[model samples]
Target: MKHILNTLIIGSLIAATASSCTAKFEDINSEPYRPGDLSADDYALGSAMNNLAGCVVSSDVNTAQFTDCLMGGPLGGYFADSNANWKATISFFNATDDWTRVFLKSDKVLPVLFSNLSVVEVVSQNTSNPVPLAIAQIIKVAAMHRVADTYGPIPYSKIGADGSITTPYDSEEMVYNKFFEELNSAIAVLNEHPNDRLTATADYIYQGDIQKWIRFANSLKLRLAMRIVNAAPDKAREMAEAAVDPQFGGVIEQNADNAAWTYFSGSVNNPLFVAKEYNHEGSKTGGDTHVAADIIAYMNGYDDPRREKYFVKSEWTGIDYVGMRRSAKVPELKTIGRKYSGINLSPNSPLYWMNAAEVSFLRAEAEAVYGFNMGGEAKTFYENGIRLSFEQWQADGVDEYLAKETKKSISYVDPNEGINSYDKELTNITVKWDESATPEQKQERIIIQKWIANWLLGNEAWADYRRTGYPHLLPATEEGNKSGGVVDSNRGARRMPYPVAEYNDNAENIEYAVNTYLGGRDDMSRDLWWAKKK
Candidate 1:
């Protein structure tokens, strides 16, 4: 009895100490720390930046690609629950921000940025400190863009809570417009602050290089402009043209200077690589999130050299796990002579992005929308975009493996052939020679090629799909699934909504905001104001 009592007392004391420590320690809190507390010019901003970047494809962009990523499979992999590859777990169907759920209290970077801005403004009142402030607001804009872009309509200019109760969702149009204004504003600020004292350590991106930030700002402007292509074409052209301004700097001209985030350098690991390839034989999160049949068919049909790099046959055993992307019954490797085309799942694989190919493609689309069938020029841009995409993924040997262009060109194909054929429930879209296609059809072919160019980066692809409606996708044959739901293998949901937790907790404000803008913000298929009407 005495010994037991002693053990109980010791346990209680230990528990009390741990409790006290947790209470005082900062990590336990759901709220972010006040930015004012930081006294250094060098502040940590990588965590917030990573989340903003990760939320795009690694989060839900793959499943929600709606059009681009599913080039191989038949029943677009988006609908099938049997998408037993590593990606399905990373992306799943209806959840874009689930991985971000646990870190929900508040994004840590916002307050830090606001605090930095406060200091910058106070320090340089009379002088125009446009450059540093521009960079700062950029961080703000990037973070907010992810939030707003992911969840259709969201709180923007009205973000701060003057100790107020809740925030409301802003109109999608208003939000997009504000994004334009903010980028311009940031540019002005960058122009104002030419001080050399500014350091790059704070920005994980470009390391505080104002010039690069300017280029990124312009690039961001181009991206946002494209978002509004359907609603306002002239406006889109105007903004895109403005980005090409030599004065503002512009998107990466070369791959060397491209804005990118690397994971291996720090404790941070590439989320995609970790979940799919490098970690636990792709089984940790779950293996081989079967590449959609549509995606498989498209690549195979083109004799796309990229096919090998992007996917591996189950018969090939570099990585263990379930079938390939097609949900195919992977045959015996030795018997079939099928080999696993290894994915560059290196922990060292580039986790961060801002690829040059994106800029080139953005330019191509910009030209296309602006009536630039301007001969081979537009096609060259399109081709360059494809080349860059292939090169990046190490799939450029397409000339060797894929069919060369013939007098009569083929376009799209049915991926239901031989080893390409997966399970019964799936269907794929492959590129075949369509000699009957006219020059315009050839243009559609060009767009389709660009479509495949967008692989891991699906948000941009989704945006492009919204703009052009290319590659022909059928709606997921589901009843309850209004958009990209469990049955939504064909079409992606229009937008992710605010978390149910946010809606329920702040019911009144959320309600007012939804009713004010689009009827029910929860409806994924209901388009954002700036998005095309189709």
Candidate 2:
């Protein structure tokens, strides 16, 4: 393979430490050399693939804690940081550059993805098989779209084009278009080579199962389609319909076909597990991360069985599954937050990319809200989503769970501090799908169930919260609104601002992005192109 030396600039941005990969590849812990330096025979496709996989949601403990736990998890209402020091950060709608920048920076998502993709492109060109490149494209869209969603305009279409640091930013709308184009191209290529196993040993998500990859791509397409429904309804309907069409291969509809990054050995641990269950010394403690009040309230009210699978009972309250309130005082966070329920996960737990349960809910939303042909009725898909979620977690009581019509999210009471408690029931939406309900109500039901099913995938949950405004999340407590009036306490942050590094490194392009595409300010208060209007 002809190595491209120019891409090393991007690689330099990524940490040189070895990534935690699946044990099937014995050399998984070998340090990642610059992508441009690898020769044809020396190229480690498995390592590159693993690195790409890890960067999607980040298998690294610190990266995951920062991007997911501190930022997306709190904003998405799935988690809250138990660390009192973080009260002024993204968890409370204050977008600190240090906290919010991780999602955009080298350690987590973009630089590593683009670098590996460049190497994969060269490999595809030298070899006749197109499988690896197709798979790489799918991974790129999966990872980069999250970056785009987090920050409105990003260096998408132009990254690594000529190895320039000052790549132009693409508008969120344009970025979504490029995502569709890439997914379409990838789906076409994979469909042609349905039996290809060129990257089988290197594939961590699906083991180079071409058919499964195709399904994942379609499911990703459906997700992107639903994301843009409010922003671009016509295009969203067209893409959503195309995604589920059998002729173009099908979306993930079975639990067996779920897409996730798996770690075979204990040395390479799941990030969420590490963040919530174990301390830095690998000893068990009241972890720095805890389940958020919003999710626990919703689940507790419905008596959801998945709570047992998703979180452990609070240490202070022994029997109750308490969660930390985002707006709690620093003293409460230091004392009560640590006692709140931590995530119920093990070191080897696989981090999900997408699952059948989420797909079923997406189809439900498409059918119920958009009136699209999803091969089933909206209520059927909605209930199926709940059922699949129960099965995914090995939780029982599905029949009774789905039959309940009156159970709704209950009020949150901070046992330690009554002032922090929210006594009024937040949402009236129930578990059972109501066919007679309006389209908006049905959408709420679909998204609420979807949010519940997407337990640890906080980034997706945050995006859904922005897109549909369902599962009414509690605002950060008055003390937690540290945005200096840039963000509303009630509405929360709309999107993360561009990292300061972007402004320092690529001033011209960043300026243009803010001026032309991002409404003249790189502020978290600004809504993304796909977000529901305030």
Candidate 3:
């Protein structure tokens, strides 16, 4: 949403490389290529993004395994690392950078094109369609947000122009502001022109529905606004205020308007789909990661029946649940296209990307932060968050999950709590959940729930855990990851390092940027500027 624009100003370099994509070149027999219109090959940009986004989130889920990795196999069942599972790959000890390159490419290229991704935006020019432009704008903003949020200050505004590898990076603060402006512009354009044709075509997501796009724009904006409250309170408050303002509107009221890309089963089972598909056929893969203990406790505490549907307890695991250390050796499974050891609800199955649940929770968070909120938004989001997560998983007894949250843990965040105020808030969440949970228990619930909602989404959960140190995720034991996969953060790992290739080639500039934004590129313990404690 609005956050996308701020990232755009940071200038993420366009990602042109792809597995199937060929180098763009001029044909000797063809007329000289013009620079104005994007080449026919440019379409691959979108194609690549669809793949990368799926992979990125899939990787994210694998890591968090709020489903299988941390909870499914490990804690729930006597842990077993099936061939298709991500337990070995994501065990707390084994974080890796294998997926960063592709993810960054998707994050960057889409944003570059979106900035000026000319989908014939001109009305009278006979080619202008605000719909595609808006979608592109939205995606671009979304893409850049992903890159910037994860990598810290990246090459944003100055990225496109072919300068030396030493291109300077922008500050996270500056990058965020640009995203706000970009979303604001997109919203304004969609409202004014409303391109149905191009939107129908370019809107690969929601099929050119302007209203849905609008909600996505607003919801995304709210998320961005909430993200920066710690770093830029005044700015964050303004963005949040604008989001709730009736005139400006807010996010989706229900799950129907979820902004997500659906994956096909066979060749296009999306990343997770394909990954599962191939793994099922005997792939060299890790076992399903188990759900985190805190999450299990919370759901179980609330008697959240969704547990069965959301996760499959390994029949093999005789323990309450078995969890593999990131360092644990994963069983090899030979497979072809895809495989499946764990279970993921279908795209049409509900809980996907950023949705009403998250937006509601975000609003609740914003209200809690502001201290003036009646918690109307918070309660709605909280209830919706819990209910939707269960329903999305096709959890068994629907009425119970819905009826479970009667005892709200509002008092957990007292200033007297042992830890930070944020910890207190999270405690209330668990406190609200547990039959006899303390304030600490309640806080864990909030962080755990947030983590649950963030499953298969992005690194936001990891980042949140680091920033707040809530939910108390267990560190990968010695049996988990023997060698650290990616850089580590205080709570876990901070922002991942820029790819080795980027650092190798663009050493000077990357060094400068990293030092400024994250203190040190190799120092995983360093918090991002925005994430650091005052």
Candidate 4:
């Protein structure tokens, strides 16, 4: 929440070096004053690129816990916090500025991205190849879009411009349009330099694979296109069509082409693994996050083969893959919730940026709903998404799994406390694609599978839930509805309130963003620009 200008000033100082020596002294002290004096190609641009990659999904443990595990994961119905102390936070529909501010903090997404982007730009200027700058642009969109999605309007397109402390907020529509433009420009540049490996050592996602970067940029464009469909249908169709047209470049279609940030053995551990399985005592069980009941119910009912891949079995008596329901009392949560299944990630696992399965599902929706040419029919893309997810997890029985037309999400049973249990099936949606199904049902099918495939990428899942109302996530319990009637218990929290620091520092812009751009009060209950009511 610190002013972007302050962060930019600090970053610029760190990036620049002082050369105080006169011409005569320079001849004697021929060595450059700092690393910045090195040739642009010799500068540590890879480190800047790697940091940008880490910021995409956040490799830091605490940041991951705050932004992903405690907020997006539960809100998206993927995982719930097992630590009872956090029950009053966003997981319970309550917006705590202390916790929510971490997403926008100078150390988190925005400042780090803008700073590193500046470094990339300055370093890449002397080089003729545009791949580094283009990749940085793609990374900028990848990282900042999450920030924009978290809060409706964000200080984008003008963060470091003119170096003003009171940065203006861009409307959600404006932010998304800028994202499209950045992706288009980056993809064009990368396409021109198809074999450029200028960013290989610095690139953690694809090791400077320009083709993969182009594919990811296109895939990202497709995602944003779908995100804005409800708000701007014509533009959404135009961008989505352009994304998969193959003339510019193809979208992510194979598992090998998936975009992810890998964890170097000694440098940084996977943050999700640390947040979910590593504790202060260096043990796994007491970590804060556990699989949420919604995912468990859906997977259990389907008899999903990937359960073993997704979660470790619960240590509690008579429970296999039981999940902790949201909003359990502190006493029950601390005592029993700790025994629920934790996420099955390891410290060395790669944090995914985007995957082929998600892209396939996007194509499936575009084809089914918008009648776009996604290189195949809806069923083909839908089935391919399932197959790709299974393959990604190394799970078996995909052939049999796709044939499942009868299984649906089963009822959630809390063996320890019936108060947390749901008696009815979560949803009646099935696995196999049905040609005669209504448009809504088809969309549900595609999104449900997409949600399952998008495990741990909770922000995207949350966005999809808000946009399409798919997977029919279980509503937060009465105890979890802590928004004082502002947020609907059934609908859940829509967007995080603007950072409290913005109110204290940039009061005028915050007011303008709320009144003019948000078109509603600055609260968690209001729907974002892309959010459609079910």
- Candidate 2: regions farther than 4 A off: 1-43, 161-165, 277-285, 316-319, 331-338
Candidate 3 lDDT, tens digit per residue, 154-235?
7776654221234577888888888899888887776675444331123345755777777788888887886776688788
lDDT, candidate 3, equals 0.48
In order of appearance, the predictions have TM-scores of: 0.68, 0.91, 0.70, 0.91
lDDT at position 497, candidate 1: 51
Model 2 Cα lDDT, one tens digit per residue, 1-534: 134542442243222423332232343433444434554422456666776777788876787878788778888998876665554578666656787887677444665676666656655665666788888889888988888888888887877722344688888899999999999999999999887885434677887788999999999999999999888989999999999999999999899999998754647677777677533222122456778889999999899999999987776654468777775564334445545676788777889999999999999999998888888999889999999999999999999999998885487876565656888878888888788999988988889889999999999999998888878888877687777788887777789887888888999999999999877988888888889633
Q: How many residue pairs clash in all the candidates, one count each?
A: 46, 1, 73, 0
lDDT of 3 at 477: 38
Off by over 4 Å in 3: 1-100, 105-126, 161-166, 194-199, 263-266, 277-298, 317-341, 345-351, 372-377, 396-399, 402-445, 479-490
Q: What ranking emerges by TM-score with the best candidate at the front?
A: 2, 4, 3, 1
Misplaced by over 4 Å in model 1 are 1-39, 43-130, 161-165, 191-200, 277-290, 316-343, 372-376, 398-403, 406-443, 473-489
Cα RMSD, model 4: 6.4
Worst 10 residues of 4 by lDDT: 17-26
For residue 305, give model 2's deviation from the true position in Å. Answer: 0.7
> How would you encode candidate 1's per-residue C-alpha lDDT over 368-485 as one tens digit per residue?
5455321235555655766677777776564442244522212222122344333332223223324454544554555566656655554555555555555554333232133244
> What does the lDDT read for residue 163 in candidate 4?
26
**lDDT accuracy of residue 209 in candidate 1:** 66
* Candidate 4: residue 161 Cα off by (Å): 6.6
| Candidate 4 lDDT by residue in tens digits, 170-255 | 88999999999999989888888897786435666886788998999999999999999999989999999999988998999999
- Estimate the TM-score for candidate 2: 0.91
